[model samples]
Target: MANPSRVFAAVLPAAGRGFAGNEKEQVLEVHTVNRQSPGDRVREVQVTGTAEVCFPADRVSVCVSLGNSKESVAEVLSSVSRRLEYILQTLRQHGVSDKDTVVRRYLHRAADLYHMDAEVVATFSDFEKMEQVCSVLLEKLDKSVCVGTPQFYHSAGCLSQLRRQVCVSAVENAQQKASEVSQLLGQSLGPPLVVREEETKEWRNEDGEFGSRGQGAALLSHLPHRPTITASSRVSVSFSLRDKSRKQL
Candidate 1:
């Protein structure tokens, strides 16, 4: 009869056949059979997507100030109060609500003179109206009133909408990439298996220009310099892959 060791060596692969003098000590590798059900054998593809969105500043706040000095506290108060009332009245006439206007006053004694300083900070959604109001205040109050430059910013609702929009755009971009990949692999793209926002970034563009120095940037340079906030989002998404032939069945 043929030797059992020689029979074992004949069945072994070429790389595993060279065991001399230590046949009993040599180890054999056994691969476990995969018993996973067909339903559990799902194939997935993962892709990363990113998007950036720029939003112009919408709301504006302007400060209007007045000061008065007199020998008596009552005189100073009367003088400042007259200008303050006029400022509030002007804002109201321009459709500014009381909730959007804030008034602050400070009283101090400089040497023997009583001094009072007051200011009203008003927030406006209408830019044209804001410009008209500023012009009216400067013309009527003249040097008595000082109107600061308008500070532009995005409202809470605007920022919330921006964040949501950027994230959704990133996800859509990822799905597009996955679809192309599936097509290349001769497969059909199914619904998403997993989706996660990997990162988010926000920054202010003080110069109000895009990052690229291309033609788009040159065109934007000629536009009004309204500082903008840019938001970016990156997402990782996994999509299920289906055999195109299986769909017909």
Candidate 2:
């Protein structure tokens, strides 16, 4: 006997009533005795795509630390406070704002010596000014201030804009691939059924880590090129498919 047409009947739960254990059995059923006209079947195509873009680092961050061993907590604190004030003044004179500086202080007792330390982090957008600032710290602050390696990075607004662009490019890639497959199969591509972001990642320059040295003015010279800031995205998309006959005119 010929197989009956596939029938999809949704038996939803009754008002204020529920089925126990046989819920799956109650919701759907297939019968071979009687047949109804077949309806259009929903179909989907899934594809994965990725995109990446790199931008030059537009900002630099310099970290400096001051440490002093004194007889009493008050003395140590007083000394560190003076050094911090001087550093802040120097940075401000070079066009660095208070918002661009971060200050941290600590006090500890170790091996019968009272250790007090202060750290100052300043960010700069102008490369020449950064160089001037670093040079002045080394010359004026002398051995008391230990300069850290300079960090190269992009501004937050720059990164956020790039991320949005990359995501859009990834989705466009997925749609292109799906359209090609649909064409090959003599089907029409419909609107996306599901669009999802699978992953996002960053790729850094592999040459060497910047500002690895604990003290440096010479090291700054070696950091000639700004580090590359890469933005990347991957997406998994599911698009609906329609038969040739069902395609829109």
Best by lDDT: 1
Which residue pairs show backbone clashes in model 1?
none
Which tens-of-lDDT digit does each residue in 92-179 have in candidate 2? 9999999999999889999877999889999999978988988998998899999988877889887888889899999999999999
TM-score of each predicted structure versus truth: 0.76, 0.54
> What TM-score would you give candidate 2 relative to the actual structure?
0.54
lDDT of model number 2 = 0.84
Alpha carbon lDDT at 234, candidate 1: 100
Model 1 over residues 1-249: C-alpha lDDT tens digits? 322221122233346456566563344555544455565579999999999998987888999989999999999999999989999999999999999999999999989999999999999999889989999999999999999977888999889989999999999999999999999999999999999999999998876534456777877664445578989999999999999888444
Global lDDT scores for all candidate models: 0.87, 0.84
Off by over 4 Å in 2: 1-39, 53-60, 66-83, 104-117, 124-129, 139-144, 152-166, 183-188, 197-221, 224-234, 242-249
Error of 1 at 45 (Å): 1.5
User: Considering only N, C-alpha and C atoms within 3 Å, which residue pairs clash in candidate 2?
Assistant: 149-211
